[model samples]
Target: MRLRLVALAALLSPLAACSTVSEAVKGPELAPVGYPAALVPRDQSVLPLASAREPLPQAASANSLWRTGARAFFNDQRASRIGDILTVQIDIDDSAKTTNATTATRTSGMTAGVPHLLGLESSLGKILPGGFDPANAIETNSSTNNAGSGQVNRSEKISLTIAAVVTSILPNGNMVIQGTQEVRTNAELRQLTVAGIVRPEDISSANTIRHTQIAEARINYGGRGDISRVQKTPAGQSLIERFSPF
Candidate 1:
């Protein structure tokens, strides 16, 4: 019986040796799910890129426009330095327009190759106010264009404020920022100054132009809004109401 068992074991060993081993190695691998890559985080407190904020359309606001703030804003005497107390005010009003009758286009917003700094100077001193100076001006000439569910509200003037400490000035006249801040002008102050500047391209609707002004103010933020009086949420509205978009 022992001899017979040994013979059977030898036969099984030879049969096992006759079988071939696979050259390809097999291992566990992962399958990719069809999920998209993560998106970047955003802070909605500020304006979003490519969002609808354009200068006022068709309806003209003012006539006198100048790119420089009193021409003094860019003067050598006006160049500020660190520790200088710079009082900055942003404004929109009819007085800020500049226009030439030679380049005037009808109110259709399709310009006949014209230029304006948020306004047409032709209207300045000629028919509209003389100059749109911010420090001593009021913005009270906004007109509303409402169509169906989309209603656009324009303040005749909307002014936003920003400030910088002037850490350093580049040799070629670019001012560096030590620290800068933005301020929300009083609602009373912005009520009438809705003059939006028409830059190289017409990217401003009266409202968007206003919004761009606010973004510029952020270059060097000034300070926080004095919104302590404002309730975190409207009275009688639930906490959910503050965040319920759906």
Candidate 2:
């Protein structure tokens, strides 16, 4: 019984050592769950467009038609102030088609012979096999043909309306805008983000502007859900594949 107990202990010792070694190789463990909300920090408040060089006038002159450099009437609803919200119309319809074809052919032939050098034809015939003409001693022929064709056809269209906030006013009076919209259904979340600079004069009378008018624009639309997880590889396996040389 004592010998049997000793044998069992010896068998378990290697497993314990292996577990320790595996833990060391793995280094640190990650959290089992992820917090999607913590991906980006939330802004508590909007920042000013620029620093005020001088205090605003306490009161406007009575006879002055313009009040404190106002560009339009007070009733105009155009977006001119920081933190103001405006509607942005996103309409994108794009299509492209391209085709290319290439063909190449190459052929080469080589022949080497010695007719009669130093009158050694008889000697060469004796050394060479019968009907083996020295003129055709070394003849080679090669042909190569290559053909390639490629085509691309793509079309995309997205139409949506999103409300954007005036994040900042540029020195040239352009407005920097940013907008985000998120929709949640069941366990899925779809997010859309847009940011860009727009000229104030380009805004329509209806207080809206098309996405095409935006400069340096960035748009993103995607979703995260069960379907997304199904399309993605496991995190551990993805890491291994990325680091693998073969």
Candidate 3:
């Protein structure tokens, strides 16, 4: 009976070891099981707010076609107020090329001699071996040459349009903008984000502005899903590579 009990314990030990190994190798949990957290409203504290300023007075004539300090057109579509939305046209084309070269060369020679020092030349033959030239003593010659070259070439282009909202108005009337868009297709989520500051005058009549018109602009485009994972190295392998000497 004791032998049977020992055999049962040995069998269960390997099962427990397998479970532990499985847990360690498991991939991180997929994003939460429901709607993405991005859908929820962002914390108000993170968004920029307009500074307190005295409101501008309205036109003196209520029936006037033009109001003081207002755009001449009544249907102006430019984005100027907080919460107003506008489109941003992104057009990026960049190319760069660089080449570097370095060259170096050096040559040196050294020699030492003792001729007729204290009349030692006459006795040198007796102390030194025959055919040994004192003038050639300690003679040396060296030369070195080095050359290096490097070249780099790169090009990138992106063209798209995304909607942005005015988040704040500066004291000078400039607008701060932030925008985020996500598209999910076949379990993959592609996201694009844009944030910047823009002058109200930069907005075109169609309520659109080019990316270059923005100041302090930041743009990001990427995606995550099974395809993204397949393109990435395994976490365990990556960790090992990070600590490896080679």
Candidate 4:
């Protein structure tokens, strides 16, 4: 079953916000708007895959389950497949900042590493043919992603993007898509984990930001695992540059 995060995240899709008054004073230049080389705005989002991964023999027969809500704010959804070439773009506004989990201990930058991701993850589930049972077909349990960078400390807002394609599907119904991803990290060590720069061992490294073994504790790190490589955003720009549900 899907590990429901908050009580809302897993259920709701992204909302398109529009019409906001200019908070800053006069603007100098207008930012670029249109299809960039980073993305292929074509007739349709192509996602051609070969096969699925082998089913989880370790998986229990079946079980009943339910979903809960989540507290995710910045996120994206894209149509994906087994194989498709992709490009990515990143943007950041170096002026966004916010309080940490506690004012006594400000977390990373409030707006740094905002994401504009374009990727395809496996839909790990049983193939019932008549669509699928989201409730029964749960993604395999994902371990804590130790993940991240000192960039979380910067007083800024940013967004990054990645492009990928599907490689093959596994028996367990996990779609093996191929695309450049931000990365997943270990929660305990706050080291880079997923696709980006920081290697899993980096976070699994002894000199982690939180300084702990990946097997022992947990770290609530962010930003493509822990690589603090968010790009600078243009002045007077929104936190999220742009995205698609492809």
Candidate 5:
């Protein structure tokens, strides 16, 4: 009995370890807050190594009040070069409703008869069931009906604001920006990420741009930790649901 118990324990140890490993693999671990390195391009440099052109010394005009390239008290703060920071406004409000109905019906009938066949009709009447008519030798009728109805209603809305850093600049003067924000409440950690391309002209004077202005935009908002894990279905259950034919 002692040997049997020891062997059973040994066999179950691997199964317990496998279950622990599967749980760890199913959920994403909370990431520490830091720069989103994945959004940066490998070939491009985040900061300019040197100025495109050396700035020429502006000769002081003794009589003029304004100098060359000097703006009136205020300056443009829009993001135009790599390494610049700008705010992105995301406001998504969408709703959809669809209904479909299909109905089909068909009916058909066919009749064949042999009233006379070389004087054999009388002989067939005696062999066939009583009250059988020669005029109606074969008759068939069929009907089919099909009806289907479907309805769908969905709605989604999300509003947020995040600051993003310019990662790269295109030849067309567009800038690619990416940002990640993380917040931890107790054990749960919420993460938000945004990345996209935007034109310099679309940026407002306040250095903010709407989400719609960003082309090829990608936004994700989710959480990791105890709460999220509880909300998600177990890995084993999810696998069975996905592979089950019924």
Candidate 6:
């Protein structure tokens, strides 16, 4: 097994080097846009489909200007079904601060003696060291002191908006949503993804919802390009740092 692993590593070394070289030369490329299902799988805490559904509408009148099934005018445009689109507004401004301190001290001492063990104290001078004292046969002392302090401060702010699709409807009327947006400027590619569950009642009449209203939300914002590559540590250095003891 060791020999096989060594051979496999040897074979993959060139490929790894080629990948690193290519990335350094060309920077990082953007990922292609795809279906939200690829990002939010069904098993990712998403609820199952509801067994009951609203009945389909009956056919419209033949001689009427306002068709029963038509969305001509004055119809509610809010997203209420699977595949319908809705806007998601995200505005975050969070901060945190923490401080802690600890101190501990301990001291102990012990002594034991056989001062009158069958009158053997007199013979102890001959059997042991000349200054040996039978009254104090064993003595020990110990002391420990510890002190620690820690502090942390952090802040975050983000503001943006994106459209999301209703992927599923739960039995209790909650909808699971997922969306991804990407933009490329020169050699840089920015990506933003959002997925979560929302209640229809929380949605505004304008078909928009706030990030705070989402449950089990997962939001990601990042980019790839020459700037990111320059800021990132090399894979070899990262591996070494991870395995190093100091």
lDDT by residue for model 2 (1-246), tens? 999999878756555434343344443332221112364353233335454222223345598655443346554466767877889999999999999999999999999988877898668888888887867778899999999999999998999889999877655456778899999999989888888878877887677899999876777777789987787666666544444334
Badly placed stretches (over 4 Å) of model 4 are 1-80, 92-153, 157-162, 168-246
lDDT, candidate 3, at 185: 100
Colliding residue pairs in candidate 6? none
The sequence of per-residue lDDT tens digits that candidate 1 reaches over residues 25-70 is: 1112223211112442432122222221222122233763433222
Which candidate, 1 or 6, has the higher TM-score?
Answer: 6
List candidate 1 segments past 4 Å from native: 1-76, 94-148, 156-164, 168-172, 177-215, 219-239
- Superposed Cα deviation of residue 236, candidate 3 (Å): 5.7
The residue-by-residue lDDT of candidate 5 on 1-246, one tens digit each, is 999999877756555434344444474443333333477433433334243122323456688755433444333455666678999998989899999999999999999988998989889979999987889999999999999999999998989999999877654456789998999999999988988878876888678999999877888888889999999888777655444434
TM-score of 2: 0.58
How many residue pairs clash in all the candidates, one count each? 50, 0, 0, 56, 0, 0
Q: Can you rank all candidates by lDDT, best first? A: 6, 5, 2, 3, 1, 4
Best by TM-score: 6
Considering only N, C-alpha and C atoms within 3 Å, which residue pairs clash in candidate 5? none
Candidate number of the best lDDT: 6
Residue-by-residue lDDT tens digits, candidate 6, 6-66: 9877766655434344454544544432324565554433344453234223346688656
Per-model TM values vs. the true structure:
0.24, 0.58, 0.59, 0.17, 0.62, 0.70
Window of ten residues with lowest summed lDDT in model 2? 28-37
Q: Could you tell which candidate, 3 or 6, scores higher by TM-score?
A: 6
Global lDDT of each candidate: 0.32, 0.71, 0.70, 0.30, 0.74, 0.75
Error of 6 at 105 (Å): 1.4
lDDT of 1: 0.32
lDDT of 3 by residue, 111-156 (tens): 8876657877767778888876666656889999999999999998
Which residue segments of model 2 deviate by more than 4 Å?
1-48, 51-72, 114-138, 232-246
Model 4 C-alpha lDDT per residue in residues 165-199, reported as the tens digit of each score:
43443332333322333344553222221111111
